[model samples]
Target: MLQHIKMYGAIVLAMIFWAFSFIWTKIAIESFQPVTLVTLRLVIAVLLLYAYAKATKKFQYIKRADLKWFVLLAFFEPYMYYMGETYSLTMLNPTLVAVIVATIPLFAPLFAFLFLKEKISPVNILGIVVSLLGVMMVIYEPQVGVETGFWGIILVFVAVFSAVFYAITLRKISSHYKTVNIILYQSIIGLFFFVPTFFITDYATITDIKITYKSLEALLMLAIFASVLAFVLFAGVVRKIGIAKTNVFVNLIPVFTAVFSWLLLGQQLGFNQWIGIVVVVSGLFVSQLSRKRKISEKIEEITQVTEY
Candidate 1:
């Protein structure tokens, strides 16, 4: 029970940090170009995580055999994922991007099954559908109806697949590396991708850059809370719970983002949005049904064996 509490707490907290990242990124992009912003975010996260791991004497060296796996993990995530999502924001409205991003877990079960041989339960499928419905309720307003282009939809879908593949690749190195080190190395290696792309894409725009204290604070918050700590906690949860079950918790991101927007940004929520939040929570509860019952059955078997 204690272990379950910790695992759930970690994932939920990770979601909260990520929810806040939306706000932070909004503030940050005011001063920095998207590619430039992501590169700097990676730079700061690498430095902070590397320093912490070194100070704690918990840094683990990567084996040569595992090097390719780490590279692939970084490619899937901070590289492809961020590149896709960030650029998509330029073409599409944030609401469309988010609703699309919220589909990550819907595709996760197939990847988890293919890569990790994890079984997907009917309840898990049902839960994902229900949660997706709730997400639409929260994010999709019939009145506003934001326009989207083909390229924008394509780019965000790139992000969705990148995230799915990232989770699959994470299982490759997560067991061998400490959570912090996994986040650290990924951030370090991610810079290789982000730096060149930054130069190629956003370099010309640099002359217009005027740094603001507010944007700096937002960037720093993104680095520390969103990139470093959130990745550590999320990686730890993935290692503990496996990808299919772990990704189910991702459905909470949009719901939490809405609530955070309401509270922090003074964005008033309507009745439908509040109802959507409740429905999203209910779906999360449904997804865990399989895990709980499977554990109970195992305990019964153990008891029976002891009686014999």
Candidate 2:
């Protein structure tokens, strides 16, 4: 019972951290370009993860056969995912960004089954339709049309697709590698992707960066709490209780993002939008409903391998 308390607390904290990540990235981007901010966050997170892994003696040498898989993982995640998510924040509010990004797990399995031949239950399909309807509710209004720019939504979907692709790559990685080790290599390798893009896209604007205290604080919070700590916490819960139970907590991210956006960022949603939040979260919970043999096995493979 005590262990359950700890794990539940840890996962809840992880959700809070991830929820705030959208807010933090919004603030941090004020001082840094999207890619620049992501690159720096990755640098800080990689260093901290490496240090922690070393201190705990949990580091593992990468297997050569798995080398390409790690590269691909970084490409999908810290590279494409961050780029999509961060750039979208430039155009969209945190709550909106959170809603779209939250759709990842809901839709990843559909993509995986479509692309990778992974199996899923009929219920998963129904849940995805419900989730998409909820997402549309959050995104559109009868009078105003879509709530944000088309490109912004498209970018967030890029993050979503990257995560979907990462789910495929995740299976190839050797399970013996510690989670920290996997993240370490991912961050390290992800930098290679980000650094070049940063130089090309945002480096010229470096001189224009404002470097305010709030931005720096937000950046550090993103690195320590969002990128590193939340991931470890979520991963621990996944190992302890398995993905089915632990993943349900991820639905809390949008709710927390909405609350924090109101409390901290002063963003508000319309009544229907709030309803959409509930609906989407409900759909996420609905997505997890699985009883048959196929869903029980495939679900363990369908969801996230890591978080922000």
Candidate 3:
């Protein structure tokens, strides 16, 4: 129980860091182009992850056969995921964007069922339904007056799908490489993918950049907390609790994002958004209960065998 609490606490901290990501992106994008910002962030991420991998001797696990999976993961995650998210944030409000991205777990089961042929339990389906309603409530502004609302939503959905693929694909990846190796190689490859984009998108300005206090602070927080710590915590949770249980925590991200936006960015969440957060959190909780029940049943069966 204490360990579980610690896991959730880590997730809460991660969500707080992530909540600031919208504001950070908005600020960073003011001076840097989308691809350029992603490039620079990934470069920094690669350096940090590389250092971590070396410090822990994780690089030794990177066999030649694992290179393909690492490259593919980079394609799905930081490369495609961050790019789409960056593009979408430019078109929508940060709060709205966070709300939209919160539907990642809604699509996770669909991806699992489609690609892995994993059966979705009724509770999982219900969780998806409730979370979908929550997402709708959160993002259903009276007037989506932005010219690019449709495209922004589509891009956000793309980010969600890419994340789902990344999560489900991790099993295949782990068969080939260790987690730190995967993180390192993926960031390295992702950085290289953004290399040419930097040139095409005027990446030269990144060096000439004046690091204002606010921008530098935001960047440091993003690099340290959002990128490194969040990923490490996420990986640890996956190892501790399995993917399905760990993923339930993701639904809580929107709740934190909304709260943080209100506190940090002075954004207001109407009653409807609050209701949405409640519904989503409730659904995720139900999913956890259902999983627990299954585990308990298995334990009972083992006990019965031992008694007999």
Candidate 4:
């Protein structure tokens, strides 16, 4: 029971860090270009993860055959995912971006069904529709003359799909490597991708950059808490429990993001947005019903077999 509590605690902590990540990115990008910010963030994360791996002697070398998989993982995540997310935040509010990102788990099972031949239940389909409705509510403000942040919404969805793709690739390689090693490789390979883009896009204007305390603090929080600590905790939770169960905790991200954005950035959610958050979270819970039922049935089967 204690172990279960600790595991859940870690998962919640990860969610909190991830929720705050949107706000941090918003703050950091005030001074740094999107690609530049991501490059620096990855560099800091790589250094921290490397030190941790070396100190604990937890580093595991990847097989030559599996090098491509790690490269693909980095491409989907730190490359495409961060690009979509950071650039989108430049146009949208942190709370709105967080709400969009919260849909990753809602779509993961569908991607799994399509790519991995995983079974999808009717409830999962229904959850997708409901969650999408919730997303529309949050993104569309009726009182506003126009659909606010239209392009930003699209960019964030790109990030969402990128994350779903990343999750799929992660499952394929997770068994072969430790979590720290996987993230370490991702950060290193991701740097190679980010550095070139940063130089091409922002390097010429680098001299105009004025560093600020908030930006520095935000970058550090993102590298340490959001990137390293959150991934470590999440990977530990997934290993301790399972992906399906661990993913259910992702629903808490928007809630945490909403609160933190309000407290830190003074970003307030309207009534419709609040209602949308609830509906989205409800959909996430509904989607997991089928998976939970399967787990329970498996447990019952084992119990009966033992009794026999």
On lDDT, the leading prediction is 2
In model 3, the worst 10-residue window by lDDT is 299-308
Estimated TM-score per prediction? 0.76, 0.93, 0.82, 0.87
lDDT of 1: 0.70
Q: In the order shown, what is each candidate's alpha-carbon RMSD?
A: 7.7, 2.3, 7.1, 6.4
Which digits, one per residue and each the tens of the lDDT, describe model 4 over residues 1-308? 99888888898998888889999999999999999899989899899999989988999888998989989988987798888899999988887788777767667667767776767678878888898888888887654435447778888988888777777667667678876788789779989899889889999999988889999999999999998888778867777777667657777788888899889988768899999988888887787675544422222221111100
Ranking by TM-score: 2, 4, 3, 1
Backbone clash pairs in model 1 (N, Cα, C under 3 Å; residues 3+ apart or in different chains), count = 0
Report the Cα lDDT for residue 260, model 1: 70
lDDT of the structure predicted as candidate 3: 0.67
Clashing pairs in 1: none
lDDT of 3 by residue, 246-280 (tens): 55556566667677777776777789978977876
lDDT pick, better of 3 and 4: 4
lDDT of each: 0.70, 0.82, 0.67, 0.78
Lowest lDDT 10-mer window, candidate 4? 299-308
Regions more than 4 Å wrong, model 1 = 1-15, 88-103, 114-119, 142-146, 149-156, 231-253, 266-270, 292-308
Indicate the residue-level lDDT of 264 in model 1: 65
Span of ten consecutive residues with least summed lDDT in model 2: 294-303
Model 2 Cα RMSD, 1 decimal: 2.3
